[model samples]
Target: MKKIIFSVLFLGVIIVLLMQTELGQMLRSGNIQEVAANIQSYGWVAFFIAIAAVVIQTFFPVIPFVLLAGANVLAFGLWVGFGVSWFAAVMAALANFALARYAARDWAEKKMGHHSFVKNLNRHAETKGFIIILLARWIPVLPSSAINTAAGISKIPFKWFLLATLLGKIPAVFFESVLGHYMINWEAHKGKLVLIGIGLVVFMLGINYVKKKKKSTLLS
Candidate 1:
């Protein structure tokens, strides 16, 4: 309880600071391109700041991460952008998992018991936790924070969590970086980008469908 309170207070302070600062103002402007341009202006320091921003956003979650991923791609291009975004996202996810497991364990457990989606995750954690984590990462609709928190609260091993997170994030982050890259250069690769986007969507949906069917079969 004390830990949770302290964490909340700390987060509150950070939020207040951000809202009063230039960073907060830029975020409030809702201009991804502008933010990207500003980050790019910082030169090499931009990569470090971008990584820190990703980690911070995971905790605060006020900013849409897709915007950050896009900004990284805009500043660093395809390969480097993907690498940075993927690494930062993995780090952020691990941080969230650790925070939930340590600082917020009791609260997270109680909350998971109350929420249906999280409840289901708790069940899967007892069995195929890795697959659950992997699938959750791929499905954009499934909240990543919830999965991280729930995994921490459940009996899933840290190794499985880490492995699943490392693998699961690949496709999603790659897709985000690639899409952003193409979007910026849309005039040249508009058709190819659209096809890639469709293919990714279809692939994710197919994997999700298969997983659901497998689950249903086991239950039956």
Candidate 2:
């Protein structure tokens, strides 16, 4: 407990220190281009900084993830940015899960046990855990921290959570990466970007339809 508190405090101190710099100004402004320029100024260490930013944001979430994604895409291009963002996000999810499961599950249960959603999560975790996590990651409307915490406190196996998170995060991460790149160079990729956006909307609609049908069947 003391260790966790200390680590959090240490991270807080680091953030405060970083906030005093010009890079921090860029980050506070939420200017993707400026953030990318700051990242580029660091050369090879830029990747490390980017990954750390993603991981930290998963826990603290003071910075918007989309901003980080956009900055990464502008700094590293689409594919590399996608790879880095996806990897960092997955790692962060795993960390959040581990922290919740190993460190805080008992406490969380005592606190969140009264919530209907947590109760439902507990009930279905063993049976529909993978699908639940997959959909949550795929849709991304749910908070990533919430999903990780819920999965941790529930009966889902680590392997199932890992697989679902890995598979489900792909499309969203890729789309975000593409969106980030297009934001910078939209004039060049306008047609392709529009098609991708349409495809994503159609895919999300199909998933929603399936989910609704499944729910109705369950109710019946």
Candidate 3:
């Protein structure tokens, strides 16, 4: 527990320092224009840095994925940006899962054991992990880190996780890329974005309701 607290505090200090830099200010502002310009300044190195940013954000998501994806779109254009975001996100998810499953599964299980949600997830993972992962991936509001860590400690097979992640991440990444591209002009897309957000919330609520109903029926 002391080690964990120290690590978190250490990370916090690093973030504070980074925020003082110009690049860090741009990142903190989440101004896609400034971020894209910064990436472009590095020339070809931009690709590597952009991909690395996506990967790193998996473990430390202080940087919003939408911002990164948007910056990629501005720097690399629509299709290439979508490709980069999707590929990097998928790879990042796998890496996070592997780290948890191989290095920290036992520790994480012990820590989260008393949590009812974790127990329920473990039970579902034994039977419906693939579908759960797939749907979870589709919900951009859900934290990818949570999904990856939970799956890593569950009984779900790696292959199933990979396949489901691959299928689920495609549309989600594409949508994010597109959203980022248009978000450059918030006023231009404000109405559409609002509608989309409302729709997503409703869709998630409906999914939850259906899931609960199905579980109740099965129990009865």
Candidate 4:
């Protein structure tokens, strides 16, 4: 049927998009000295590269924003990292949002016909988008990049989406930025910093759980 055909095409596109790049390999290296040298020479240029990666990386299996966000903290410091990560995250979300609103929705509606499980999910995300974004960012399983696309496509309000993206992403981005700071000065306060990140993550999770329960109850 139409659904089967659409599914096949979707799978094919996913396979094509995940093809690896040379740069992706270089950055994944754990050699801190090598990474430091590259940053020392190319720090300014790397900022733009990070932006480009956020825009294009929706295709790849890799989570480019998370990688770059961590890198910003290590190379630039916490405030710089937080700013870069937040900006890139917001820009990428906006791009994905436009694509979903303009392109994917019609195709999805046609293929799924009606009665989709996401019909309700989309409604929730659209109405309480800020909370939804916060929850998605907190939930480790869902890629923040993916959420950007989904939120856009779901026709969530632009203002809500932007607000959610900024506030919601704070927990993870802050944690990683702080984590990088610790790694840089790790011998000083190692255990304490680690505990702090863990606590923040757990607190965010509790917030997400309560929000979900309340939303579900109201929707029901």
Candidate 5:
């Protein structure tokens, strides 16, 4: 607990310092295009940094993954950016899983014991582990870190977890990459961007509605 708290505080201090830098200022501005352009100026090093950022954010949960995905697309184009983002997400998930299972074992166990949702996930993991993980990954609003932690503490096989993560991340990463690409190039593809945005909104709404219905049914 002391180590985790210290690490978080240390990270917070680093973030505060970074926010004072020009690059961090750009990030804080939330201009994805400008941030991507700046990061791209560093060439190949930026790719490694981007991946590291994804992994770090998995533990920290400070940076918005969506913005990072968009920045990758702007920096590396559609295909390469999609590949990088997808791979990074996978790596991050695996890292978090390992952390929960090993480094944060006590924390993971405590979280599982305290959270009813996590307990439910653990129960489902005993049987339909892959499906439970797949749905959590497929649904953007679901807390990915918590799910990863819960899965790590459960009896689910690592192979199933890996397979489900790989399969589930494809569409989400693709959506982020395409949407980001089009959004950055909006002047040339305004109509397509609008359609994509509308489609995404509808999809999210439908998912939320289904979740609400499921919750209500369970309560009843």
Candidate 6:
């Protein structure tokens, strides 16, 4: 398990290194406008291309926020872009949820579980679990994909999971979309960035406190 994780991390580093190149950025930026402009010169075909990319994110595990979502908001107004972003993100979370539950169930149980938190999470789901999933979506830093998969293995029913996800993921993405939209107007974006930084620091402190409590319990 550790070996697999290390391999994935190593490959990620290599990919990031490659992506640091200007040429890589040019390609990955989804510069459909420039490409299509070269082909035609008058009209832009970037809209269709971006939507297609959003759909592809469901299968590909790509978070197309900058080029797809944020750019969508910037190009098209906040409402339309935000709606598309929410749909794409929910679909991706759903895909990961099922994949982790049915395909990598045993492996994930061994790796991601093995902790009291995970056990309790499962126990909650064994009874009533939708609330926890909803909370995960409410927290911006908690990846919806992780929450979805964790809930799936929590022994939560598929129907409940689906309903929770559909209802829960909306606000999360909408909030992010608003952030991205506000960011288009640079001054507001700066304030939001500072708030995000402060939020991260608080989150880390909270996590550290929890860890210390757990350690103290072990010592006792």
Name the candidate that leads on lDDT: 1
Q: Could you tell me which residue pairs clash in candidate 4?
A: 97-152, 100-153
- Which candidate would rank higher by TM-score, 2 or 3? 3
Write one digit per residue (lDDT tens) for candidate 5, span 1-80. 76577546655654764455555666556677787887688888888766765665566555577777888888888788
Once superposed on the true structure, which residue ranges of model 5 sit more than 4 Å away at CA?
1-29, 183-194, 208-220
List residue ranges in candidate 6 displaced over 4 A.
Answer: 1-68, 115-117, 184-188, 195-220
Which lDDT value does model 3 have at 165? 92
lDDT tens digits by residue: candidate 3, 3-108? 4555456446546545555556676676778878887888888777677667656666666888789789998899988998899999888877876677666666
TM-score-based ranking: 1, 3, 2, 5, 4, 6
Q: How many residue pairs clash in each candidate?
A: 0, 0, 0, 2, 0, 0
List, residue by residue over 88-155, the lDDT tens digit for candidate 6: 67666666676567666776677666755457678888566777676667765565555766765678
User: Model 2 over residues 57-101: C-alpha lDDT tens digits?
Assistant: 787676677668877888898788888899988988997788677
Q: Between the candidate structures 4 and 6, which one is better when assessed by TM-score?
A: 4
lDDT of candidate 3 at residue 51, scale 0 to 100: 72
Q: Write the per-residue lDDT of candidate 4 for residues 1-220, one digit (tens) a residue.
A: 5545654565454444334543444444444434434554565886765555444445443543454555666666668767776676677667556655555656545543243323544777656766766667766657665576566556467788788777876776776556655665568968977787797688778878997999899999
> What tens digits encode model 1's per-residue C-alpha lDDT throughout 67-126?
778778887887888889999999888977887788877777777757765667667775
Listing every candidate in turn, what is its Cα RMSD in Å to the true structure after a full C-alpha superposition? Answer: 2.9, 3.2, 4.0, 6.0, 3.9, 7.6
Weakest 10 consecutive residues of candidate 1 by summed lDDT: 21-30
lDDT of 2: 0.78
Model 3: weakest 10-residue lDDT segment is 2-11
TM-score pick, better of 3 and 6: 3
